[model samples]
Target: MEYISFYNGNEMPIVGLGTFRVENNDECKASVKHAIESGFTHIDTAMIYENEDKVGEGIAEGLAATGLKRSDLFITSKLWLADYGRENVAEAYETSLKKLGLDYLDLYLMHWPGTDEAVMIDTWQGMEDLYKENKVKNIGVSNFNVEHLEALLAQVSIKPVINQVEFHPYLLQASLNRYLDVQNIHMESWSPLMNAQILEDETVKAIAKEVGKSPAQVIIRWNIEHGVVVIPKSVTPSRIEENLEVFDFSLTAEQIERLDKLNENSRIGPDPVEYSGH
Candidate 1:
Protein backbone atom coordinates (compact mmCIF):
# COMPACT_ATOMS: atom_id res chain seq x y z
CA MET A 1 0.00 0.00 0.00
CA GLU A 2 1.45 3.40 -1.06
CA TYR A 3 1.20 6.41 1.32
CA ILE A 4 1.36 10.19 1.34
CA SER A 5 3.09 12.02 4.21
CA PHE A 6 1.06 15.03 5.34
CA TYR A 7 2.50 18.45 6.22
CA ASN A 8 2.31 17.54 9.92
CA GLY A 9 4.38 14.38 9.29
CA ASN A 10 1.56 11.86 9.58
CA GLU A 11 1.35 9.20 6.86
CA MET A 12 -1.95 8.55 5.03
CA PRO A 13 -2.74 5.76 2.65
CA ILE A 14 -2.91 6.89 -0.95
CA VAL A 15 -5.97 4.74 -1.54
CA GLY A 16 -8.96 4.15 0.74
CA LEU A 17 -12.46 2.65 0.76
CA GLY A 18 -15.31 5.18 0.66
CA THR A 19 -18.59 4.34 2.41
CA PHE A 20 -20.92 7.00 1.09
CA ARG A 21 -24.08 5.16 0.07
CA VAL A 22 -23.34 1.95 1.91
CA GLU A 23 -26.37 2.36 4.18
CA ASN A 24 -27.57 -1.20 4.64
CA ASN A 25 -26.06 -2.50 7.84
CA ASP A 26 -25.35 -5.99 6.55
CA GLU A 27 -24.05 -4.77 3.20
CA CYS A 28 -21.90 -2.05 4.71
CA LYS A 29 -20.46 -4.46 7.25
CA ALA A 30 -19.68 -7.02 4.57
CA SER A 31 -18.15 -4.51 2.17
CA VAL A 32 -15.81 -3.05 4.81
CA LYS A 33 -14.95 -6.48 6.11
CA HIS A 34 -14.11 -7.63 2.59
CA ALA A 35 -12.02 -4.54 1.99
CA ILE A 36 -10.06 -5.06 5.19
CA GLU A 37 -9.56 -8.68 4.36
CA SER A 38 -8.22 -7.56 0.99
CA GLY A 39 -5.55 -5.39 2.75
CA PHE A 40 -7.33 -2.03 2.77
CA THR A 41 -6.61 -0.15 6.01
CA HIS A 42 -8.23 3.20 5.37
CA ILE A 43 -11.99 3.85 5.70
CA ASP A 44 -13.90 7.09 4.95
CA THR A 45 -17.39 7.88 6.28
CA ALA A 46 -19.50 10.89 7.31
CA MET A 47 -22.30 11.78 9.71
CA ILE A 48 -24.39 13.10 6.81
CA TYR A 49 -24.38 9.57 5.43
CA GLU A 50 -25.95 8.33 8.68
CA ASN A 51 -23.97 5.09 8.34
CA GLU A 52 -21.24 5.58 10.93
CA ASP A 53 -22.73 3.02 13.29
CA LYS A 54 -22.88 0.46 10.52
CA VAL A 55 -19.36 1.46 9.52
CA GLY A 56 -18.28 0.91 13.10
CA GLU A 57 -19.80 -2.54 13.11
CA GLY A 58 -17.90 -3.33 9.90
CA ILE A 59 -14.62 -2.00 11.29
CA ALA A 60 -15.02 -3.98 14.48
CA GLU A 61 -15.75 -7.16 12.57
CA GLY A 62 -12.87 -6.51 10.20
CA LEU A 63 -10.42 -5.99 13.06
CA ALA A 64 -11.61 -9.13 14.77
CA ALA A 65 -11.48 -11.10 11.54
CA THR A 66 -8.03 -9.86 10.60
CA GLY A 67 -6.51 -9.29 14.03
CA LEU A 68 -5.50 -5.77 13.11
CA LYS A 69 -5.17 -3.10 15.80
CA ARG A 70 -6.79 0.34 15.87
CA SER A 71 -3.52 2.07 15.07
CA ASP A 72 -3.15 0.10 11.89
CA LEU A 73 -6.26 1.62 10.28
CA PHE A 74 -6.86 5.22 9.20
CA ILE A 75 -10.49 5.95 10.11
CA THR A 76 -11.95 9.33 9.03
CA SER A 77 -15.37 10.89 9.71
CA LYS A 78 -16.93 14.32 8.99
CA LEU A 79 -19.18 16.73 10.92
CA TRP A 80 -22.47 17.50 9.16
CA LEU A 81 -23.95 20.91 8.19
CA ALA A 82 -26.73 20.85 10.77
CA ASP A 83 -24.05 20.62 13.47
CA TYR A 84 -22.10 23.60 12.16
CA GLY A 85 -21.86 25.93 15.16
CA ARG A 86 -19.08 25.84 17.76
CA GLU A 87 -21.28 24.42 20.52
CA ASN A 88 -23.08 22.05 18.20
CA VAL A 89 -19.84 20.97 16.52
CA ALA A 90 -18.29 19.98 19.82
CA GLU A 91 -21.31 17.89 20.68
CA ALA A 92 -21.69 16.48 17.17
CA TYR A 93 -18.08 15.34 17.01
CA GLU A 94 -18.50 13.58 20.35
CA THR A 95 -21.60 11.86 19.05
CA SER A 96 -19.79 10.66 15.93
CA LEU A 97 -16.90 9.35 18.00
CA LYS A 98 -19.22 7.39 20.26
CA LYS A 99 -21.12 6.02 17.29
CA LEU A 100 -17.86 5.01 15.61
CA GLY A 101 -16.80 3.34 18.90
CA LEU A 102 -13.28 4.60 18.50
CA ASP A 103 -11.13 6.13 21.23
CA TYR A 104 -9.65 8.75 18.88
CA LEU A 105 -10.41 9.46 15.25
CA ASP A 106 -7.49 9.38 12.84
CA LEU A 107 -8.98 12.42 11.06
CA TYR A 108 -12.11 14.58 11.41
CA LEU A 109 -13.26 17.18 8.88
CA MET A 110 -15.96 19.80 8.41
CA HIS A 111 -18.43 18.14 6.04
CA TRP A 112 -19.05 21.49 4.33
CA PRO A 113 -18.19 25.16 4.77
CA GLY A 114 -21.72 25.89 6.05
CA THR A 115 -23.61 29.18 5.66
CA ASP A 116 -22.28 30.91 8.81
CA GLU A 117 -18.69 32.10 9.05
CA ALA A 118 -18.87 32.36 12.82
CA VAL A 119 -20.09 28.79 12.98
CA MET A 120 -17.23 27.63 10.80
CA ILE A 121 -14.68 29.43 12.95
CA ASP A 122 -16.23 28.01 16.09
CA THR A 123 -16.14 24.55 14.60
CA TRP A 124 -12.45 24.91 13.86
CA GLN A 125 -11.88 26.03 17.40
CA GLY A 126 -13.70 22.96 18.64
CA MET A 127 -11.50 20.83 16.40
CA GLU A 128 -8.46 22.57 17.85
CA ASP A 129 -9.73 21.74 21.31
CA LEU A 130 -10.22 18.14 20.29
CA TYR A 131 -6.70 17.92 18.91
CA LYS A 132 -5.33 19.45 22.11
CA GLU A 133 -7.37 16.97 24.12
CA ASN A 134 -6.03 14.07 22.01
CA LYS A 135 -9.48 13.17 20.74
CA VAL A 136 -8.64 13.55 17.02
CA LYS A 137 -5.25 13.18 15.41
CA ASN A 138 -5.88 15.62 12.56
CA ILE A 139 -8.53 18.08 11.34
CA GLY A 140 -9.54 19.16 7.81
CA VAL A 141 -12.30 20.60 5.61
CA SER A 142 -14.38 19.13 2.78
CA ASN A 143 -15.87 20.61 -0.41
CA PHE A 144 -14.12 23.94 0.29
CA ASN A 145 -12.92 26.02 -2.63
CA VAL A 146 -9.96 28.42 -2.64
CA GLU A 147 -12.00 31.29 -1.19
CA HIS A 148 -13.33 29.15 1.61
CA LEU A 149 -9.84 27.87 2.29
CA GLU A 150 -8.60 31.44 2.49
CA ALA A 151 -11.34 32.28 4.94
CA LEU A 152 -10.43 29.34 7.17
CA LEU A 153 -6.72 30.05 6.84
CA ALA A 154 -7.04 33.65 8.02
CA GLN A 155 -8.65 32.76 11.34
CA VAL A 156 -7.43 29.32 12.45
CA SER A 157 -4.19 28.71 14.29
CA ILE A 158 -3.83 25.14 13.05
CA LYS A 159 -4.17 25.14 9.29
CA PRO A 160 -6.51 22.57 7.80
CA VAL A 161 -4.53 19.42 7.20
CA ILE A 162 -6.58 18.41 4.15
CA ASN A 163 -9.40 19.43 1.80
CA GLN A 164 -11.48 16.69 0.19
CA VAL A 165 -13.52 17.34 -2.91
CA GLU A 166 -15.23 15.55 -5.78
CA PHE A 167 -12.38 15.06 -8.22
CA HIS A 168 -12.21 12.87 -11.33
CA PRO A 169 -11.13 12.95 -14.96
CA TYR A 170 -14.08 15.20 -15.85
CA LEU A 171 -13.42 17.71 -13.04
CA LEU A 172 -9.64 18.07 -12.98
CA GLN A 173 -9.43 21.00 -10.51
CA ALA A 174 -5.86 21.79 -11.52
CA SER A 175 -5.97 25.42 -10.39
CA LEU A 176 -7.43 24.55 -7.02
CA ASN A 177 -4.84 21.82 -6.61
CA ARG A 178 -2.04 24.25 -7.41
CA TYR A 179 -3.30 26.65 -4.74
CA LEU A 180 -3.55 23.85 -2.20
CA ASP A 181 -0.08 22.67 -3.12
CA VAL A 182 1.28 26.12 -2.32
CA GLN A 183 -0.21 25.87 1.17
CA ASN A 184 1.18 22.33 1.61
CA ILE A 185 -2.38 21.15 2.16
CA HIS A 186 -3.16 17.62 0.99
CA MET A 187 -6.16 16.96 -1.30
CA GLU A 188 -8.45 13.94 -1.19
CA SER A 189 -10.85 12.68 -3.87
CA TRP A 190 -14.38 11.60 -2.94
CA SER A 191 -15.64 10.23 -6.25
CA PRO A 192 -12.30 9.21 -7.63
CA LEU A 193 -13.70 6.49 -9.88
CA MET A 194 -16.20 8.90 -11.44
CA ASN A 195 -18.96 6.32 -11.49
CA ALA A 196 -16.69 3.94 -13.45
CA GLN A 197 -17.20 5.83 -16.69
CA ILE A 198 -13.45 6.10 -17.17
CA LEU A 199 -13.60 2.50 -18.16
CA GLU A 200 -15.60 3.56 -21.19
CA ASP A 201 -13.70 6.76 -21.99
CA GLU A 202 -11.90 6.44 -25.33
CA THR A 203 -8.81 8.24 -24.10
CA VAL A 204 -8.56 6.20 -20.92
CA LYS A 205 -9.21 3.01 -22.86
CA ALA A 206 -6.43 3.92 -25.29
CA ILE A 207 -4.05 4.51 -22.39
CA ALA A 208 -5.10 1.20 -20.87
CA LYS A 209 -4.32 -0.59 -24.11
CA GLU A 210 -0.92 1.07 -24.35
CA VAL A 211 -0.08 0.34 -20.71
CA GLY A 212 -1.52 -3.19 -20.67
CA LYS A 213 -3.75 -2.20 -17.71
CA SER A 214 -7.43 -1.55 -17.27
CA PRO A 215 -8.81 1.98 -17.70
CA ALA A 216 -9.90 1.96 -14.08
CA GLN A 217 -6.33 1.17 -13.08
CA VAL A 218 -4.99 3.90 -15.35
CA ILE A 219 -7.19 6.68 -13.89
CA ILE A 220 -6.66 5.53 -10.32
CA ARG A 221 -2.95 5.35 -10.94
CA TRP A 222 -3.06 8.83 -12.40
CA ASN A 223 -4.66 10.12 -9.19
CA ILE A 224 -1.98 8.49 -7.02
CA GLU A 225 0.84 9.68 -9.27
CA HIS A 226 -0.52 13.21 -8.96
CA GLY A 227 -0.32 12.94 -5.15
CA VAL A 228 -4.04 12.91 -4.44
CA VAL A 229 -5.56 10.71 -1.72
CA VAL A 230 -8.47 8.91 -3.38
CA ILE A 231 -11.34 6.82 -2.04
CA PRO A 232 -13.01 4.81 -4.84
CA LYS A 233 -16.01 3.05 -3.41
CA SER A 234 -17.09 -0.42 -4.59
CA VAL A 235 -19.51 -3.00 -3.27
CA THR A 236 -18.22 -5.74 -5.55
CA PRO A 237 -15.26 -7.67 -4.18
CA SER A 238 -13.50 -7.90 -7.54
CA ARG A 239 -13.84 -4.17 -8.18
CA ILE A 240 -12.56 -3.43 -4.68
CA GLU A 241 -9.44 -5.52 -5.21
CA GLU A 242 -8.94 -4.28 -8.77
CA ASN A 243 -8.94 -0.67 -7.56
CA LEU A 244 -5.91 -1.42 -5.38
CA GLU A 245 -3.98 -3.21 -8.12
CA VAL A 246 -2.57 0.11 -9.35
CA PHE A 247 0.74 0.09 -7.48
CA ASP A 248 2.78 -2.03 -9.91
CA PHE A 249 2.58 0.12 -13.06
CA SER A 250 3.24 3.72 -14.02
CA LEU A 251 1.79 6.14 -16.61
CA THR A 252 3.95 7.71 -19.27
CA ALA A 253 4.18 11.49 -19.71
CA GLU A 254 2.36 11.39 -23.03
CA GLN A 255 -0.39 9.19 -21.63
CA ILE A 256 -0.79 11.55 -18.70
CA GLU A 257 -1.11 14.49 -21.08
CA ARG A 258 -3.78 12.72 -23.05
CA LEU A 259 -5.66 11.90 -19.87
CA ASP A 260 -5.36 15.51 -18.73
CA LYS A 261 -7.16 16.58 -21.90
CA LEU A 262 -10.15 14.54 -20.77
CA ASN A 263 -11.11 17.06 -18.09
CA GLU A 264 -14.45 18.76 -18.83
CA ASN A 265 -14.64 20.96 -15.71
CA SER A 266 -17.79 19.07 -14.82
CA ARG A 267 -19.01 18.28 -11.33
CA ILE A 268 -21.28 15.37 -10.40
CA GLY A 269 -22.27 17.07 -7.14
CA PRO A 270 -23.09 20.63 -6.01
CA ASP A 271 -21.53 23.53 -7.88
CA PRO A 272 -18.92 25.37 -5.82
CA VAL A 273 -19.22 28.66 -7.75
CA GLU A 274 -22.68 29.45 -6.40
CA TYR A 275 -21.96 27.58 -3.21
CA SER A 276 -22.59 29.84 -0.19
CA GLY A 277 -20.21 27.60 1.74
CA HIS A 278 -22.48 24.61 2.31
Candidate 2:
Protein backbone atom coordinates (compact mmCIF):
# COMPACT_ATOMS: atom_id res chain seq x y z
CA MET A 1 0.00 0.00 0.00
CA GLU A 2 1.13 3.55 -0.75
CA TYR A 3 0.85 6.30 1.86
CA ILE A 4 0.75 10.06 1.53
CA SER A 5 2.30 11.99 4.40
CA PHE A 6 0.05 14.89 5.39
CA TYR A 7 1.53 18.31 6.04
CA ASN A 8 1.42 17.42 9.75
CA GLY A 9 3.82 14.53 9.09
CA ASN A 10 1.11 11.93 9.63
CA GLU A 11 0.77 9.19 7.03
CA MET A 12 -2.51 7.76 5.65
CA PRO A 13 -2.96 4.82 3.34
CA ILE A 14 -3.56 6.03 -0.19
CA VAL A 15 -6.33 3.50 -0.58
CA GLY A 16 -9.08 2.70 1.96
CA LEU A 17 -12.43 0.95 2.21
CA GLY A 18 -15.29 3.45 2.07
CA THR A 19 -18.35 2.42 4.11
CA PHE A 20 -20.97 4.72 2.66
CA ARG A 21 -24.21 2.82 2.00
CA VAL A 22 -23.08 -0.53 3.39
CA GLU A 23 -26.15 -0.83 5.63
CA ASN A 24 -26.41 -4.57 6.24
CA ASN A 25 -25.01 -5.18 9.69
CA ASP A 26 -23.38 -8.55 9.04
CA GLU A 27 -22.06 -7.47 5.66
CA CYS A 28 -20.55 -4.28 7.05
CA LYS A 29 -18.81 -6.17 9.83
CA ALA A 30 -17.59 -8.89 7.53
CA SER A 31 -16.43 -6.37 4.97
CA VAL A 32 -14.39 -4.45 7.51
CA LYS A 33 -12.88 -7.61 8.94
CA HIS A 34 -12.16 -9.01 5.50
CA ALA A 35 -10.65 -5.75 4.33
CA ILE A 36 -8.15 -5.68 7.18
CA GLU A 37 -7.21 -9.31 6.56
CA SER A 38 -6.88 -8.43 2.88
CA GLY A 39 -4.08 -5.94 3.71
CA PHE A 40 -6.22 -2.82 3.92
CA THR A 41 -5.54 -1.18 7.28
CA HIS A 42 -7.28 2.05 6.42
CA ILE A 43 -11.06 1.87 6.87
CA ASP A 44 -13.24 4.95 6.34
CA THR A 45 -16.63 5.39 8.00
CA ALA A 46 -18.94 8.23 8.92
CA MET A 47 -21.60 8.99 11.53
CA ILE A 48 -24.28 9.27 8.85
CA TYR A 49 -23.35 5.85 7.50
CA GLU A 50 -24.92 4.25 10.64
CA ASN A 51 -22.49 1.31 10.57
CA GLU A 52 -19.76 2.34 12.96
CA ASP A 53 -20.79 -0.26 15.56
CA LYS A 54 -20.53 -3.07 13.06
CA VAL A 55 -17.27 -1.62 11.74
CA GLY A 56 -15.94 -1.54 15.28
CA GLU A 57 -16.91 -5.15 15.77
CA GLY A 58 -15.08 -6.05 12.61
CA ILE A 59 -12.01 -4.17 13.80
CA ALA A 60 -12.01 -6.19 17.02
CA GLU A 61 -12.40 -9.44 15.13
CA GLY A 62 -9.72 -8.49 12.60
CA LEU A 63 -7.35 -7.59 15.42
CA ALA A 64 -7.94 -10.84 17.27
CA ALA A 65 -7.60 -12.77 14.06
CA THR A 66 -4.34 -11.11 12.97
CA GLY A 67 -2.91 -9.99 16.32
CA LEU A 68 -2.62 -6.47 15.02
CA LYS A 69 -2.58 -3.60 17.48
CA ARG A 70 -4.95 -0.63 17.31
CA SER A 71 -2.07 1.62 16.32
CA ASP A 72 -1.33 -0.66 13.43
CA LEU A 73 -4.46 0.62 11.64
CA PHE A 74 -5.42 3.99 10.20
CA ILE A 75 -9.14 4.46 10.95
CA THR A 76 -11.13 7.51 9.83
CA SER A 77 -14.66 8.80 10.53
CA LYS A 78 -16.62 11.96 9.71
CA LEU A 79 -18.88 14.46 11.47
CA TRP A 80 -22.27 15.11 9.90
CA LEU A 81 -23.85 18.54 9.54
CA ALA A 82 -26.54 17.95 12.16
CA ASP A 83 -23.73 17.42 14.68
CA TYR A 84 -21.67 20.50 13.74
CA GLY A 85 -21.34 22.87 16.66
CA ARG A 86 -18.55 24.03 18.94
CA GLU A 87 -19.64 21.81 21.82
CA ASN A 88 -21.31 19.29 19.55
CA VAL A 89 -18.14 18.67 17.56
CA ALA A 90 -16.40 17.02 20.48
CA GLU A 91 -19.63 15.39 21.53
CA ALA A 92 -20.01 13.85 18.09
CA TYR A 93 -16.36 12.77 18.04
CA GLU A 94 -16.74 11.04 21.38
CA THR A 95 -19.86 9.29 20.19
CA SER A 96 -18.19 8.12 16.97
CA LEU A 97 -15.07 6.95 18.82
CA LYS A 98 -17.24 5.03 21.24
CA LYS A 99 -19.18 3.46 18.42
CA LEU A 100 -15.93 2.47 16.68
CA GLY A 101 -14.58 1.10 19.99
CA LEU A 102 -11.50 3.22 19.54
CA ASP A 103 -9.73 5.54 21.94
CA TYR A 104 -8.57 7.87 19.14
CA LEU A 105 -9.15 8.12 15.41
CA ASP A 106 -6.30 8.32 12.94
CA LEU A 107 -8.27 10.96 11.04
CA TYR A 108 -11.55 12.83 11.58
CA LEU A 109 -13.20 14.89 8.86
CA MET A 110 -16.00 17.43 8.69
CA HIS A 111 -18.26 15.51 6.35
CA TRP A 112 -19.64 18.45 4.38
CA PRO A 113 -19.20 22.18 3.85
CA GLY A 114 -22.90 22.84 4.50
CA THR A 115 -24.41 26.27 3.67
CA ASP A 116 -23.08 28.53 6.37
CA GLU A 117 -19.38 29.28 6.67
CA ALA A 118 -19.67 30.55 10.26
CA VAL A 119 -20.96 27.27 11.63
CA MET A 120 -18.29 25.47 9.63
CA ILE A 121 -15.58 27.65 11.13
CA ASP A 122 -16.97 27.18 14.65
CA THR A 123 -17.12 23.45 14.17
CA TRP A 124 -13.53 23.48 12.92
CA GLN A 125 -12.38 25.25 16.12
CA GLY A 126 -13.75 22.34 18.09
CA MET A 127 -11.78 19.95 15.91
CA GLU A 128 -8.64 21.99 16.54
CA ASP A 129 -9.30 21.69 20.25
CA LEU A 130 -9.62 17.94 19.88
CA TYR A 131 -6.28 17.83 18.09
CA LYS A 132 -4.69 19.86 20.90
CA GLU A 133 -6.12 17.43 23.45
CA ASN A 134 -4.97 14.47 21.34
CA LYS A 135 -8.44 13.01 21.08
CA VAL A 136 -8.08 12.82 17.27
CA LYS A 137 -4.75 12.55 15.48
CA ASN A 138 -5.83 14.29 12.22
CA ILE A 139 -8.72 16.55 11.14
CA GLY A 140 -9.93 17.41 7.63
CA VAL A 141 -12.96 18.40 5.52
CA SER A 142 -14.93 16.66 2.82
CA ASN A 143 -16.73 18.23 -0.18
CA PHE A 144 -15.17 21.58 0.44
CA ASN A 145 -14.11 23.89 -2.40
CA VAL A 146 -11.39 26.51 -2.33
CA GLU A 147 -13.68 29.26 -0.98
CA HIS A 148 -14.79 27.16 1.95
CA LEU A 149 -11.23 26.20 2.77
CA GLU A 150 -9.97 29.78 2.65
CA ALA A 151 -12.63 31.03 5.05
CA LEU A 152 -12.02 28.21 7.50
CA LEU A 153 -8.26 28.70 7.36
CA ALA A 154 -8.61 32.41 8.02
CA GLN A 155 -10.41 31.71 11.29
CA VAL A 156 -8.62 28.62 12.55
CA SER A 157 -5.09 27.92 13.70
CA ILE A 158 -4.70 24.67 11.75
CA LYS A 159 -5.83 24.14 8.19
CA PRO A 160 -7.44 20.88 7.20
CA VAL A 161 -4.98 18.12 6.34
CA ILE A 162 -7.09 16.89 3.41
CA ASN A 163 -10.29 17.43 1.46
CA GLN A 164 -12.48 14.48 0.52
CA VAL A 165 -14.69 14.89 -2.53
CA GLU A 166 -16.43 13.13 -5.38
CA PHE A 167 -13.83 12.64 -8.10
CA HIS A 168 -13.74 10.27 -11.03
CA PRO A 169 -13.12 10.19 -14.75
CA TYR A 170 -16.40 12.12 -15.06
CA LEU A 171 -15.70 14.63 -12.30
CA LEU A 172 -11.99 15.35 -12.46
CA GLN A 173 -12.06 18.22 -9.92
CA ALA A 174 -9.09 19.86 -11.61
CA SER A 175 -9.39 23.40 -10.27
CA LEU A 176 -9.80 22.19 -6.73
CA ASN A 177 -6.90 19.83 -7.19
CA ARG A 178 -4.55 22.63 -8.19
CA TYR A 179 -5.57 24.78 -5.19
CA LEU A 180 -5.15 21.89 -2.75
CA ASP A 181 -1.68 21.15 -4.09
CA VAL A 182 -0.69 24.76 -3.52
CA GLN A 183 -2.07 24.71 0.05
CA ASN A 184 -0.07 21.63 1.02
CA ILE A 185 -3.35 19.86 1.74
CA HIS A 186 -3.94 16.35 0.48
CA MET A 187 -6.94 15.30 -1.65
CA GLU A 188 -9.02 12.15 -1.21
CA SER A 189 -11.40 10.80 -3.86
CA TRP A 190 -14.71 9.48 -2.54
CA SER A 191 -16.76 7.60 -5.12
CA PRO A 192 -13.66 7.44 -7.25
CA LEU A 193 -15.45 5.00 -9.53
CA MET A 194 -18.40 7.35 -9.94
CA ASN A 195 -20.81 4.86 -8.43
CA ALA A 196 -19.52 2.33 -10.99
CA GLN A 197 -20.82 4.58 -13.72
CA ILE A 198 -17.48 5.16 -15.35
CA LEU A 199 -16.47 1.53 -15.45
CA GLU A 200 -18.24 0.99 -18.78
CA ASP A 201 -16.84 4.05 -20.49
CA GLU A 202 -14.98 3.16 -23.66
CA THR A 203 -11.94 5.11 -22.59
CA VAL A 204 -11.89 3.37 -19.21
CA LYS A 205 -12.49 -0.04 -20.76
CA ALA A 206 -9.82 0.58 -23.37
CA ILE A 207 -7.23 1.43 -20.74
CA ALA A 208 -8.28 -1.49 -18.54
CA LYS A 209 -7.77 -3.82 -21.48
CA GLU A 210 -4.38 -2.31 -22.17
CA VAL A 211 -3.25 -2.75 -18.57
CA GLY A 212 -4.87 -6.20 -18.18
CA LYS A 213 -6.83 -4.89 -15.20
CA SER A 214 -10.48 -4.37 -14.41
CA PRO A 215 -12.08 -1.09 -15.37
CA ALA A 216 -12.37 -0.36 -11.65
CA GLN A 217 -8.62 -0.81 -11.27
CA VAL A 218 -7.94 1.56 -14.14
CA ILE A 219 -10.11 4.28 -12.60
CA ILE A 220 -8.50 3.79 -9.20
CA ARG A 221 -5.02 3.91 -10.69
CA TRP A 222 -5.94 7.15 -12.35
CA ASN A 223 -6.74 8.70 -8.98
CA ILE A 224 -3.62 7.21 -7.36
CA GLU A 225 -1.41 8.61 -10.10
CA HIS A 226 -3.04 12.01 -9.64
CA GLY A 227 -1.74 11.99 -6.05
CA VAL A 228 -5.23 11.77 -4.55
CA VAL A 229 -6.37 9.16 -2.02
CA VAL A 230 -8.97 6.70 -3.36
CA ILE A 231 -11.74 4.99 -1.36
CA PRO A 232 -13.89 2.63 -3.40
CA LYS A 233 -16.74 1.07 -1.42
CA SER A 234 -17.61 -2.61 -1.66
CA VAL A 235 -19.08 -5.37 0.55
CA THR A 236 -18.23 -8.43 -1.51
CA PRO A 237 -15.05 -10.11 -0.29
CA SER A 238 -13.71 -10.78 -3.77
CA ARG A 239 -14.38 -7.25 -4.95
CA ILE A 240 -12.82 -5.89 -1.78
CA GLU A 241 -9.61 -7.79 -2.49
CA GLU A 242 -9.75 -6.80 -6.14
CA ASN A 243 -9.92 -3.12 -5.23
CA LEU A 244 -6.73 -3.45 -3.22
CA GLU A 245 -4.99 -5.12 -6.15
CA VAL A 246 -4.41 -1.69 -7.77
CA PHE A 247 -0.86 -1.20 -6.49
CA ASP A 248 0.77 -3.84 -8.72
CA PHE A 249 0.56 -1.76 -11.91
CA SER A 250 0.32 1.85 -12.99
CA LEU A 251 -1.39 3.99 -15.65
CA THR A 252 0.90 5.67 -18.12
CA ALA A 253 0.82 9.47 -18.45
CA GLU A 254 -0.94 9.21 -21.80
CA GLN A 255 -3.60 6.92 -20.33
CA ILE A 256 -4.11 9.23 -17.36
CA GLU A 257 -4.62 12.11 -19.75
CA ARG A 258 -7.18 10.09 -21.68
CA LEU A 259 -9.10 9.46 -18.47
CA ASP A 260 -8.71 13.09 -17.51
CA LYS A 261 -10.12 14.21 -20.82
CA LEU A 262 -13.27 12.21 -20.11
CA ASN A 263 -14.26 14.67 -17.38
CA GLU A 264 -17.79 16.04 -17.39
CA ASN A 265 -17.51 17.65 -13.95
CA SER A 266 -20.26 15.43 -12.65
CA ARG A 267 -21.06 14.23 -9.13
CA ILE A 268 -22.95 11.23 -7.74
CA GLY A 269 -23.13 12.49 -4.16
CA PRO A 270 -24.55 15.49 -2.36
CA ASP A 271 -22.88 18.86 -2.83
CA PRO A 272 -21.33 19.95 0.45
CA VAL A 273 -21.37 23.64 -0.47
CA GLU A 274 -25.08 23.81 -1.25
CA TYR A 275 -26.17 21.24 1.30
CA SER A 276 -28.57 22.97 3.73
CA GLY A 277 -28.54 20.59 6.68
CA HIS A 278 -26.01 22.54 8.65
Best by lDDT: 2
lDDT of 2: 0.91
TM-score of candidate 1 to 2 decimals = 0.96
Tens digits of lDDT, candidate 1, 158-222: 98889999898888999989999999999999888777766788888889999898888898899
Residue pairs in clash, model 2: none
Residue 248, candidate 1: Cα error in Å is 0.7
Residue 35, model 2, lDDT: 93
TM-scores for every predicted model: 0.96, 0.98
Compose the digit string of candidate 2's lDDT tens values, residues 1-278.
Answer: 99999999999999999999988498899999999999889999999999999999999998988889999899999999899888899889999999999999999999888888888898899889999998889999999998998898778899899999989988888899999999999999998888788888999999999999999998888888998999999999999999999989998889999989998877788776688753
Backbone clash pairs in model 2 (N, Cα, C under 3 Å; residues 3+ apart or in different chains), count: 0
Give the lDDT of residue 60 in candidate 1.
93
